[model samples]
Target: MVKPVIAERGGAAAGDDARNGERAASVRWALAGLSLCVLLPSLGISVANVALPTLADAFGAPFQDVQWIVLSYLLAITSLIVGAGRLGDLAGRRRLLLGGIALFTLASALCGAAPTLWLLVAARAAQGVGAAVMMALAMALVAGTVPASRVGGAMGLLGTMSAVGTALGPSLGGGLIAGFGWRAIFLAGLPLGLLAFALARRHLPADRREDRDGTTGGTADGTARGRAGFDGLGTLLLALTLAAYALAMTMGRGAFGPLTLALLLAAACGAGLFLRVEANAASPLIRPAMLRDPALGRGLAANALVSTVMMATLVVGPFHLSHALGLDTGPAGLALSAGPLAAALAGVPAGRLTDRFGARRMTVAGLAGMAAGTVLLSGLPAALGAALGVAGYLAPLVVVTIGYALFQTANNTAVMTGVRPDQRGLTSGLLNLARNLGLVTGASAMGAVFAAAAGDVATAGAEAVASGTRATFAVAAGLIAAALAVTVAGRRARPGQTADGA
Candidate 1:
């Protein structure tokens, strides 16, 4: 009897261990799927940017019309990200993620097939909506899936994947454009999107919200079970605000007229209305109280600033490389790849560093590096005739990219970790919102500055391009410096804050 009992106990223990191992494997696969989800959209955006001129030529559209391809995507994401995140929180995140992948894949196919510029722009807008949903839920999924101690590392890995996708995008797009056509850029997303969807469906667990009884659903946490009602009014107001703001910014540079002023005023009114609605709503799309948290607020500001600086560089860098240096499309794309490549290589290590040291230190260091690189790049025009001019240009990119990698990983980890489990979705949305807003703002602002300095490139020639590039870099450096100052001040104010809690 005693021997039989012992054998049964041993068998049960072995089975439990096997189950644990299986669970671990599932989580790993789920994370892998999420990484791919993050990567594909990132890759798509960068690749599209490289193919812009080709797109213009193919469609017989002017530069201004072609600009809409990128603008429409940014506008859609800015408008929908927060709402999609809130919906994910109420519904299942996995469900939203899968839906997003399907939409994005379909949109990619549509974009590739579109014959007209307007239709392609519309398809790109659809793709942006899907990208927003996936981006908003990605960090929340990471927080929910990984152990608290490992969240930083996981966030780091996702960051690395994003950087790698971005790094490879230009090169891939250039190659595709050279070999096939501009349409191939959109077609490329199909396979990657489908693969991610399948993996996510197979490996990601069902929604697991904790209640008072430690059960799946209960009233203990103050969250209602089932579908959280959508905030249609809030969504509309926010959309209006973002759309107006983007329109004004993008159009304002070309001509500062009554339309720009009207759009700006509309954006302000929409913002005010959105704030009023959020403050009064029972199930608010964004929690007013959470924004007051020092860690979350400051972290988001830093994120926006960093994004602004990076986007400014990306927008202006290609122009400088091609027009000023006389590099071909492929070589220009390869040159631009340097920054993201450095960022990708540094991303994982930066996350590990964030986990070891606090996020504040890493953020500060990263911003400082960005500031330095921008300042260096600002002087590149004067050195163009020198032997080291190319080196000078490439070196700053490496520095800026490294800084971006460290700052992004640490800052994202800090913000997500600082939030409550239930708030992760909204937090993720806000984080991405800041980033998209920054991208639009940066591009518009830099473009205007470049135009002002360069003044009709057809007449001004290479000198105009060089002058504008310098001015843009100088302005970017200043913005980053301001961000660095804000970060340091916030850190000093909250000496006890850390990013390990989430």
Candidate 2:
């Protein structure tokens, strides 16, 4: 009788362990779906970059107008991301994610079918609003769903997906544009978005808001609490500030006229008003206390700076490849794909390293690598005409991408871990906001430099293109060096602490 009882107990233990394994597998699948959602929008951004020249030709638009194709999307995301995150916290991340996917799908369809350049830009802006919602909630959802011990790994995996998406974009987009047309890039998002929406709805849990009392704001049966009030005034002011600033930057290098002056003034006034409104609002869009946190603020600044360098390189590299090197659309796209491919390969390993070592060390190392890579790229034009020219050009991109992977994985982990559980959504929003803002600012700044150097891309000769490319890289290197300095300073400001200073 004793022997029989012991065998039964062992069988019961085995059964329980099997069930746990099954549950873990389910969670992993859900996380994978979430990563897919992240991947789609990221891919869209890079793919659109490669398609810019094609779009300009198709619509007979100038380079300045063509740029708005990219800028409009980023601008919309920057303006609305914080508000989206706040809504996710008040409503539900799963719900908002589903909504975002739907809207993104609709916008993608519209973008593909747009008959005019302005209409296409409008559609891209709408797409940005949808992308912002997804970006704001993605990290927060991951943090909420996964165990704290595994957060770094999960973040890494998500980052990997993002890198892969970006890596694939240029190559895939080039092939599609070469084979079909530029419209194919926009149309590609439709199926991906729809599938992601369906899978997310089925697999992702319906998370409720966490209350101030450390309990979930839900009924006993698990229904969500009432939604919080919206901050319309705060949202409007923030949007206006960002729009004005981005407009100023976009037009700064052009003419330097009255409109630019007015935009700068509007941006200044709007920024001041935004701060005042946020400070006094009952339910602030961004918490003043959170901004005061040294780690968060510095992390955000570093994120923006890094993004600026990365986007500047991406925007400038394709033109250089096509115009200066006389490469076709396909080859140029393939060349541009190198960096993101390196980033994809490095992302997971970097994440694991961050988990094992610490975010601070990895972040510093990453920034240093970025600075070195940018400096090397600045001389690529001179180097490329040598025996090992291609290698010289490609090697620096690999280093830069690897650094980006390490920095992003470690820094994101730091930012997420530094904030309170309830604040994750807002923090995620801010993170994305910084990134998108960087993209817009970098694109504008670098495009201006290229224009000033090259005279006109459509009409410029090879030598002019080369000159512009070299100059842009030089400026980019300076930006990265400055970022490295900031990172070093931030580290010194908080000794014996990790990237999050936790």
Candidate 2, residues 1-502, lDDT tens digits: the string is 9999999999999999999897688678778778887898788787898898999999998998998898898778777888888777766778888999889889999999999999999999999989888888888788777776677777788889888887888778888899989888999898888888877887787766461213435633475644345678998898889888877776675446799889989989998999999887756677677787878888899999899888877777877777776789867767887888888889889888877777777888788888888887777654354445456667887898899888888788878876766678788888888877787678777888878988889999877877887788788888778777777777743444544434
- Residue-wise C-alpha lDDT for candidate 1, range 176-283, written one tens digit per residue: 999988889999899989989998999987876640112244333576644346677888788889899888877776466999889989999989988999887755
List candidate 1 segments past 4 Å from native. Answer: 1-17, 53-66, 211-228, 322-329, 379-387, 453-470, 492-502
Q: Which residue pairs overlap in candidate 2's backbone?
A: none
Give candidate 1's TM-score.
0.87
Q: Return the lDDT, model 1, position 241.
A: 92
TM-scores for candidates 1 onward, in order: 0.87, 0.85
Give the 10-residue window scoring lowest on summed lDDT in candidate 1. Answer: 211-220
Q: lDDT values of the candidates?
A: 0.82, 0.80
Q: Tell me the deviation in Å of residue 281 in model 2.
A: 0.8
